[model samples]
Target: MNETLSLFGLATTPLELLSFVLSVVTVWLNIRQNHWAWLFAILSSGLYGGVFFDAKLYGDMGLQLVFITVSVWGWYQWLHGDDTHERLPVTQLTARGRAVAALAWLGAFAVLAWFLRSFTDTDVPYADGFLTAGSLVGQVLLSRKRLENWHVWIAVDVLYVGLYLHKGLLLTAVLYAMFVVMAAIGLRAWRRSMGQHGQASATMVLK
Candidate 1:
């Protein structure tokens, strides 16, 4: 089979096409709060691992491995992290929590950027490391049911779109572009969930 085909003047490969479809489904499921999203996340991350590797985006390749680990943890947490087997509910982080998460992302970017620059031949080390660190922080927030995760994803996806375009991964660039839109939708949906839950809890207290 041909590895690359011209799709509206972009490189579209079978593998990238598969990854794109799975990634879209995964995010849509995530917005709907379906644990099945984690399963698809695992699959998409595995495929993206190869996709990024072929593009010499080593940081992203490593990030995919981390994503798989996080997805498994997220799968279990979403299924059983509540009082029993109930699904996890979205909640906002405190100001301090947000600060701490931001600190962690900055710290990770510094470390990973140094490592990639010192040891790897990656061209866009800073951008790659920045996105990788942002993704790590976002995944951690997401697994813990934080509403701020979508914000992190929205930011990361924008950078990723540009980085992939620079690296000549047109399909992956398009994928991240879609991710940015979906992350915005997810932010709106999760905020709605949190608002409704808070109202319900208040009513229970009144009762």
Candidate 2:
């Protein structure tokens, strides 16, 4: 599966190509608020773990394992995380929640970067750690149906493009570039969903 082939004039493997397709589908379903996205997320993350390992990106390889675990929790959350055990609704974080998330990202970055730098021979430990931390924040926010998850994804995906290119993963770099655009679309879509949820809540109160 790792055998190299030319696609779009760039060298890539079947494993990476498969992961790319699954990841795209995963994000598209996520934008639509479909629970099945988590299933695809798990598959893509597992595949990408092998791909990243081959590239010697230990941080990202480790992150793919985390993603697999989180995807399972995220699947359950999407199905029954809301009050009364219904599907979760789109919602924004409170001010304090946002502050906490930001702090968590920074703190995770510190620990991950230090560990990667000291323990791993990977050349881009800092970048890997930083992006890995950001992705974890985004994934948690997404699992809870938070509206700001798209914002975090936008930032992380943008940086991921450059990182993948530096690692000579041309197809994955293009995938992240596409993710940036899809994340913007997701932001707009979720904002509309949040507005609808708010209206529904107000109606229930009025009733």
For each candidate in turn, the TM-score is 0.96, 0.98
RMSD after CA superposition, every candidate: 1.4, 0.7
Per-residue accuracy of model 1 over 75-194 as CA lDDT, tens digit each: 999888878667788899999999999999999999999999999999989998999999999999999889999999999999888888888889889989999999999999999999
Which candidate ranks first by TM-score, i.e. highest? 2
Query: How many clashing pairs per prediction, in order?
Result: 0, 0
Mind giving the per-residue lDDT tens digits that candidate 2 earns over 82-120?
888998999999999999999999999999999999999
Over 4 Å off in model 2, which ranges? none
With candidate 2 superimposed using the best TM-score fit, by how many Å does residue 91's alpha carbon deviate from the native? 0.5
> Number of clashes in model 1?
0
TM-score of predicted structure 1: 0.96
Which candidate gets the maximum lDDT versus the true structure?
Answer: 2
